[model samples]
Each structure stands twice: as structure tokens, then as C-alpha cells.
Target: MDDPPRVGSTDVAVLPSDGGTNQPTVTEAPTTPTVTDSPAPTGDRTDPEQVAREFMTTYPRDVRELSDPTFLASLEGVNTALLDQVTDRSLEQAGHDSDETYERYAYTVTGTYQGQVQAFYSMVVARPAEPGEGGGAAENDLPFQVHSFDWAPGMIGDEDRPGPAAGKPVPITTEEREELIGQVRTDVIDPILTFDPDESPEQRQERLDELTVEPSTVTPPMSRSGRYAMIKETLSQTYSTEHGGPITITYAGTWVDPYDPTHNGSWSLTAAMAREDDDGFVVRSVEETAPSEGSG
Candidate 1:
């Protein structure tokens, strides 16, 4: 008997040319090469939803960090100018809160702007005030960065409305206007005019927190030396306060300097107010208006 065919050989029967008996022949078959699939191409970094999600996940919670120039440079395709404007406004409003935790949730591509995808997102952030802190911990809808080439970030105004469209200025009733003005007086004007010579740092911060929606809006006017006794009155309503809009109140005032009476002079200020949840209005920003004509 012929030796058994080798392990990798194919067995075949061959007949001799003289046609006598059939002989078994072993033939080697070509080895088939192994095939493997290469890993799928890495996910497209330019994908719009992917970029937005990555941005939200890695976004800096600290306002100071967001202000860094590198923060915008790290983004792939963002409108730095538009983003900076919105971010600066938002930081001015809520930058001073302590112990902030941001959680990104639902997101959708709203539309395309300037050939770039615009993504609108919703996130729940926990801003927990420190122990003995006046504001306390609250969950509110705040402005967050949106990814787009030309569109600015969408701000969350109310819980019912999820996008930037929610906060458009709406007409306010006469009663509502009076109520808002009262809030500005109690929450903003009074705080600015009142000066405590012996106030502690903690006490001053608590007072500021009580005045504005966030403590960061107004700086505590206190120092070791004598503080200026500010006198503010003659409030003029330059712009109507609308619901879900900004309230601009211009005040004519004078600053009294105890050390140098000559330094005391007439001054004017404009306080910009924003609606804070359902709790009336609160001062969001304060800027010096051009002083009106007056004698020193």
C-alpha cells in the first residue's frame, strides 16, 4: 500500500499510460492565505454632533478657565467672537458661584448656520453654595456653550422653553412693572447706598448675595480705611422692564468722601436687571453711566 497522503496533500487516483492498474497519487494543494478585516476607520472628528458632545463633556466649569485663550483654540470649528460675547455675558452673571457641577444630558442639531452645524443642548448644573453661604444650592437653567461655526451659544431661559427663543422680551403689565422697580430698589439700590464702617467680610458678602441674584454682580464696598458714603436717588426709568428681558435703571447720585470732601462729586449709574426664576428680578450687572451736567 502507498504511504498515507501527507497531512496537507490532496489524494488523487492516476492511471498509467499503458492502462494496467490504477495508482494512488498524492498532490500538494496550494495553501489558502488567512484573511482578516482591518479595524474600521476611526470615527470622524469633524462630525457635528460628535464635536458638540465632546465640547460639552470636556467644557470647563470654571469661568476663569473658560476665559483662557487656549480654551477657544482647543475647539475644532467654533466662532470665537460670537462664543466670547455670550461667554463673557454668562460669566458676568454666574461666575462667582462656588462648588459647581455640570452634567450634560440631551442634545440635538438645531440647524446649519454658515454651512456649519448648530447644536442645541440641555444640561443640569448643580451650583451648591458653601456651608453658611447665603444663596444656597439651586438648580437653574443657565447659558451653555453651543457648537457652531457662526452661531452664538444658545442660552436656556426657562425650563419650559429649552432654546434661545424662550427669552425674548415680552410686554409686562403695569403692576408687574411697579413690582420689578420695587425689587430693583430693595435688591440693588439700597445695597449700594448702604455702607457699614464696621462690617465684617463675611457680613458684606452675605449682604451682596441678598442684593443680587448672584453675589458676583456687585463688589462689596468695604475697606480698612473710611469708606465712601454713597448717596443715590432720582431714579429714571430709561427702558421698560419686560418679562424675560433686561431692566435698565439709571440713577443720579453723589459720592461723599469723608477724608477728601473735594473728591465727592455727582455720579450716575445704570443697573441692568434680569429675571431670576419666579423670584421677581435681580441685579445682574452695574455700569457707570455718563455723569449728568452738575457742579462739583
Candidate 2:
């Protein structure tokens, strides 16, 4: 008869040397090995601010460094298009050369290359962070990724138009705010918006004359104060972050229509007063527009 089939590692059959009987023999089974997986160093970190700051610091100045593995973690949350944007712009500003320092925004050249940047700037803005779900703090809620990345033509610092006002917005009290509103009415809205048209030229002259005297004689607009709010009232600065972009007290308000005083339409006015160190706030400009920019 054919010999008994052999089994794998589990058991072996031994032929009896005495020819008495075929018996099975068992040998020790081989030992199984243990295994463990190691994760990447920065793959598990949760601090978005730290990660972003680090990424900005370590990101390569040379375009070639984009493929470097050392920066993989820092660029974890950034998208390819944004990365490409920065790379392209930086290279353009740096004159297609290597970047040297982030010390003071001169990021186009290092001692390694001949580069100088006079009119280029790059900015990174991150969105505000919020807490994760389940109430308690968690990494998922933090603004762990860049929200906006842009390359402007010139450097933007506190010294610029809006930059100058960036010097700690000056806080004003409720009384001061009211006073500003009153000033806005007397100096701004009353002149262009409050005019009756039917009133005699002398009356208009009187109104204009009143403006010359201190404590402005013009009766402030009735609903102007309540209707209009300071554009930068809460910003804590004399200047508003509006298009004009200066240290100016600016406001917009509506007045009851003289023609349609009952309930038809109203006059909308936007006024601005500049802030000078010596003169303080002065109404220097005013413009009238349709009720709203759009007809609707």
C-alpha cells in the first residue's frame, strides 16, 4: 500500500523500525512572530496654529524643495493649487531666484543666490478656529489649515492707509458716539439731505451761516441719529475700514422725505469727517446716493 500522506508542520508519521505498526509523531510547532506599525511623526499632531507657523518657517525657498519629504507634514492641509500659487508668485517676486529670509518680508533671496525684492509681498490669512462637536475641546475644530493665501503687488504694513489706522482702534463711549452722530447730522446730512428747497434763499444762507459758528446752529436731523450707525463704531479706531480708508468718522443715515414726508421715500446720505491730530474730528466730506446702491 502507498505510504501515508504527510501533514504540514502539524504532525509527522514515523515508520516503525520493528515493522510493528505505523505510528504518528508530533514535533513542536514553529513560533509565530510579532509585528507593530509605526506612524509618521507629524501625522497625528492637532495644533493648527503651530503647524501653519512651522510650515511657513520650513517651507523651502527654492522651488525644487516642493518635492522634499521633510515638508510633507507642514503642507498636510494645504491644497496643491494654493501651494502652486505661492511657489509661482514667490519665484516671480524673487526674480526667479532662491529665497533667503522671512526676517522682514524679504523672502526672495538668500546668501546662496543674487536676489533682491523691492515691490513684492505675500500674505497668509487663517480663519478663526472653533471648538469641535461633542462640546469638549478637540483637534478637529481648530483652523488647522490655511484659509487664504495671496500674493499682493506691494508690501502691506500698518503704515499703509488702513495700516495706519491699525494702531489700536480708538475706543469711544456711548456719549462720544452720540456726539459723533450729532456732528454727522449737523455737518453732513443736514446740508444736502435736510434742505427744504421751498425755503427762501435767506433761510438756506442762515443754515449755511449757522454752520460757521461753533456748537453748530443747524438743528440736527430728527431721525438721523437713531437711523444711522457709525460704520467703524465697534472697531476702536478713528478711521473706518471703508473704501475711503482713512482716520475718518463716516456714517450713512436716512431722513424723512420732505416731498413724501408721509410714508413714501426717504433721502439717504453718507458723510465723512476726517481726524487730524490737531483739529481732531472734522466734517470734511459728504456724498449723496440713491437709497441703496441697487434700485431694489
Candidate 3:
């Protein structure tokens, strides 16, 4: 028989993905990146929120903790569809909350699983002192423990789209495709264009010019901060110059990342150069777009 809804059960109740109206975001699917092994948290864990955050950050349970048994119990209310996702191999951005009512916890989790699918859902916990056990008779004995978990299932394979057609009057060879990608990196991508919603073309160019010829400004984490982001994978192909005159041979491609291995997003670009000229294959422009659902 299913367990009864108790004090902390409300915390485990399914929550909205957007946390608005307490409604789930069912209309839109989530993104799935490829699963990758990430470092786990170690050291002191004196707080319940800390433990729950750790569970959400690097979930899938590479190693269980003393708190896991109760944490798992808290999850009993979660549906099987969503519970299956708890074995996440790679978790994405997670949101969390706790209630004073029952000392409850709620987590909105998303991550990549082994099959390259995005598993998203919610986990709620009703955290309160359990019946007195002999181990610690003292009232002040402290250790924020979990009593139960509530769950709500989200999407499994989202954040992926369809591939672009490689239809060109003349098909470029595999070698040509690789060559074109390399050229695009230097001529177009290297100079780098920062995305700005309101910025104009001239403004973008001006901003690009002001920057030094250095890689992007992302600061590499000194160590595993437990923060995770899905790595997006790119695949490319080239077309014949005959398809488009001045455009020469067009290069088209699709994106497939760690999550949602099933979906592929479209991307393409054009360049101008002679057939035999390697350096001459200068990039005229490039376009890397994400699906409306949003993916790498």
C-alpha cells in the first residue's frame, strides 16, 4: 500500500517548473545533454538544504550518504516516471526551496541520462524529527535529516530538434567540410560576436573591435564547484559552389549534445574561395542557431 501523506508530504508534492501558480510546465519539453561523469561534494554536511542541494547537483548517486536512506524515503511519493530520472548520470541547472511548515524541501532537477535523454522532474522532502531512536536520546542532538520525499515527473527526451538538409548542387567532400569548419573558426568565429538583443550590426562590429584577440571571458573553475552545464556537440557538412553562385560551396550542419541524443538542431554558413585554394576559403558568414526549445 502507498504511504499516507503526512506533515512533510506537501513539500514533495509536484511543483511548477517555472514555480508559477504551482503548475507544472507541461507544454514545453526540456533539453537533454550527453551524460558525463562529474565530481561530487565532500566534507562537512551539517545542513539539510546542503545535502538536498548536493543530491540535486550531482544526482544519480555515485555514492550514497547516511542521509540517503531517509532521502529515498521522502521520494516515495514521486511517480515512477519521475523516480526513474533520479538515477541521472548528468544533472543540469537545478532549483530548490524549503518550507518552514514541516521543515520540508523541494527541488526542480534536470539532467542527462545514459541514453542521451533529458530527465527533468521535481523532488520534495518533508524533513522533521522522526520517532526517538536509541542512538541519540538527547533532544538537542543535531543532524538535519530527511524524513520523506515527494516527487513530480517532468520530461525525459527534450532540447533536441531536426537536422538540416545537405542539398547543394555540388557536394563537398568530407575533407572539404572539415576544412571549411576550420576556416570559419578563424575568419568568423575567432573575431567573435557577442550576442546582444538590442545591439545593431555596426554596434556588434564596434564591440568586437574593442576586444583583444583573446579567447572568451569564461573563468575556468579552479576545482569542481559542483556546477554543471551540458556540453553541446557539433557536426558539419559542405555543399558544392554550384548550389549558390557567390556563396560558393555552402557549409551546413546540425547540433547534438550530451542530452537528448535523439534530437538534432540545424546550423549552416557560407564562404567564398577557389576550389584548390585552402587559405582562400575565407568565411563570408556563419550562423549557429538553437531550436525554439533551446539547446546547444
Best by TM-score: 1
lDDT of 1 by residue, 1-296 (tens): 23312222422111111100011110011112222222232344322233344444444332322211212221322222323222211110111112223212112224333444443322111111232334333423232322111112343334665444333322222223324455565556667556776776678767665444334334322222555444444535333333333446666655545554444455555666543322223455556654533234
Question: In candidate 2, what are the lDDT values of residues 163-243, reduced to their tens digit?
Answer: 211222122211233245555555544463453535665775555543321222333233232332212111121223243
What's the candidate order when arranged by decreasing lDDT? 1, 3, 2
lDDT of each: 0.35, 0.29, 0.33
RMSD of each: 33.3, 33.3, 25.5
| TM-score per model over all chains | 0.33, 0.27, 0.24
Ranking by TM-score: 1, 2, 3
lDDT pick, better of 2 and 3: 3
The reply for model 2, stretches above 4 Å from the true place, is 1-179, 196-198, 201-206, 209-240, 248-263, 292-296
lDDT of 2: 0.29
Summed backbone clashes in each candidate are: 0, 7, 13
lDDT of 3 by residue, 1-296 (tens): 22312223322111112111122211111122222232243444544445556656543443145243423322222223433533543333233233222333334455554454443444432333332355432332344433222222223222363111111111122123324445554444434422344556576555543321211332111112223323333354343333224323344444343444444344444433322111122232233332322332
